[model samples]
Target: MRYVGWTILITFWVALGAALHYTLPQRDVVRIVRVFEERQDLNDWTRIFWSRPDEQSDTFISRDVQFLQTVRANGRPMVYRNEDTGWSWPPYFKFDTSNLFTEAADATSTRAAPEWYVITHYGWRNEFLTIFPNAISLRQVDGPDASKGIPWVNIIILTTIAAIFYAIWVRWRRFRRARIDPTLEEIQDSWEAAGDAVSEKRGRIRRWLDTWKAK
Candidate 1:
């Protein structure tokens, strides 16, 4: 039971970490090789990975999604889906999918004179499931090696979250120590007293039995 409880707690933390990593905004430094749009099917399980633009009524199985094709500093490929995430989970308040497409188009550059841009995005890319991260915003950078660190916005958000959780845990421990521990101690004492009384009564009954036998 102890091992099972630890396993459950570790699994929960791992899942929460993954969820936060996927939802929080991360920056990628890359050069835009191209930008385009495609009509995608959202009828399958992968639909949750895509955002519902402007909280529109969900009736369409297919919609047009803009995409940015880019090559990272290491010459590897990275593609991002450009979509609006208005009034939704991970609320970016973004409603300029078309405008972002225009900016991406203007920022496109060649390998000889590569134009690097830092893109703010959220989500994971799973080629097997055909899902891509949604690019929240972008800005042109000096070079391909502009910055590879996690954005400061994400750092602040994570720190705030950790502080909040720590505060709650401390208060909960204090509450348990102050209120619950005393009650539990009282119950334990009552249980031991009851057991002692039962043993004493059994001893008295045995003594009476011995006297009657002697008579």
Candidate 2:
């Protein structure tokens, strides 16, 4: 029971540390998208890109076009798309000139823009912030028509889980150490005393010849 208690306490501390260390940026992607929408006033130009009136179906169908318009409206500083040959607009084009942003392409088929597709950008390098400004910059730099999902979703999830376990393991170790029967110093002193007692019983002459006697 005592050992268990110690383990739990140590585990708690370790888990706390790991939890702090392994924090994930809270779903910034959605927040960033919202910010981009608001800053860029995407609603105004959404019609120019889509032209359709319906909400769900139209929005889904026109995502590529709308995204493209947003990038272009933002000064074309930081977005791009994969323009391939085939259906209407492009096939797949990587944008991010700096080579730091990751892109994913979404394929959408329509007569107006055959190659039209949505591209999502993620994993942008911090250095590009000077020019791009926000997450939208990365999307723009890469290309609007590009359709890629955010890159690190799985990695973030795994890292979070690992952090939790790591924290637990660390606390457990700390607890175990705390519960140990004899501390390092105590063990060391006990051994030293035993040696000194043996030497002292040997005789005065032996003690004098010993290292302690010399000191």
Whole-model Cα lDDT of every candidate shown, in order: 0.90, 0.38
lDDT of 1 by residue, 6-120 (tens): 9999999999899999999988899999999999998668888989755452677888889999999999999999988888877889999889999999999999998899998
Worst 10 residues of 2 by lDDT: 29-38
TM-score (all chains, Cα) for each model: 0.89, 0.27
Residue pairs in clash, model 1 = none
**Candidate 1 residue spans exceeding 4 A from truth:** 1-8, 55-57, 148-150, 208-215
Tell me the lDDT of model 1 at 34.
94
lDDT accuracy of residue 198 in candidate 2: 82
